[model samples]
Target: MPGYRKAVAILMFAVTAWYSEARAGDTPTYSISIVPQFDHRRIEAIWRPIIERLEPMTGFHFQLVMEPTIPAFEKALNAGAYDFAYMNPYHYVVAHRLQGYQPIVRDVENDLYGVVVVAKGTGHRSGPSSQRSGQDL
Candidate 1:
């Protein structure tokens, strides 16, 4: 988890440096919006401790913002309602184009890939069986 911690610390440093320059002396409160993959409570539970710990180290305050749904998250993200956001790569592309958001860091420990789960005996052999059955498709 050291790599994860280092990434987060670096992110906080970037945020602190940027915001500090924007408003010198005053502590800045940045809103961090996460994609609504999990419920709000779960997201908060997972992030709150980390943010709280970073506050003192970074000399900034963080507000965790969670949207109820993916659409709502997208809407907020498009509006640039957050200073920081944890989003999928697809959303990151859209955000970068729309809001000039830059990627400061990324998770390199695990590779993320989408999975399609279909019921057994459904004759859906291919992962997304549109043309043919099984991997031959």
Candidate 2:
């Protein structure tokens, strides 16, 4: 399946499981936060449709939280402001450390990798840092 569809399906299953575990007679509204890689308008436009459909299917209300910047989002995420979150691996590591957040899914098809660039004659190679120098790129 396509990455987005697979992601949504996995999220739906997770949300459903959480919803079923809530205490009796308690109707909780969950918050979903996405990393602020895009502006609020674009983020909402992309996520709102998915959340709207999820609400009815899961029998739970969801609030989409959009932060204005990456730092702002990270601050909120670290503070445990969100019930659910979509974040980069670095943020995920911090979030898991600080808030004990458990990962429900990962996009194996679209893995994230870092690239390093340096001057041509700086005794640096383009691949791993070990090939270039002892210092990390």
Candidate 3:
């Protein structure tokens, strides 16, 4: 099988196990994907616990895809390869413009917007700055 098929198979196994275990209750089928970020191993390690908790708590099958490159991820998202995704600002905006992606939920504690700042002298960077203070960031 191809890599995506393998991934889907693995995810399906996890979901199936979760579903069987949670046979007492109704469950929604979840399809989730994370955007490409700089830290792959670290994030994946951290997220395992989150997934473990989610499967039991939600009693739903989850399908998660983690990619390591933005260009490739964008291509995949454009192809509608995922049911849900966590993407960055530019990609989020672009995806909305191109493919109609919108945020359904966010972690209020840490889901702050992006910030762009340039040196006092040059002032040649692109985009505007965040109005919020650094303490929140």
The best candidate by TM-score is: 2
Q: Over 4 Å off in model 3, which ranges?
A: 1-29, 107-137
What are the RMSD figures for all models against the true structure?
14.8, 13.5, 14.6
Task: For model 3, give the RMSD to the true fold.
Answer: 14.6
TM-score of 1: 0.67
- Model 3 lDDT, residue 84, Cα: 58
Task: Choose the strongest candidate by lDDT.
Answer: 2
lDDT of 1 by residue, 31-93 (tens): 788788877887787668778876876677878888889999888887777877777678877
Clashes of each: 0, 0, 0
TM per prediction: 0.67, 0.72, 0.54
Residue by residue across 30-113, what tens digits does model 3's lDDT show? 556666565777656645555666576557755667776878888877666665566656766666566665443322233443
In candidate 3, which residue pairs get closer than 3 Å at backbone N, Cα or C atoms, i.e. clash? none
- Residue 132's C-alpha lDDT in candidate 3? 25
lDDT of each: 0.61, 0.65, 0.50
lDDT of 3: 0.50
The worst-scoring run of ten residues by lDDT in candidate 1 lies at 113-122
lDDT of 2 by residue, 59-105 (tens): 77889989889999889888888877787778877876787665555
Where is the poorest 10-residue window by lDDT in model 2? 113-122
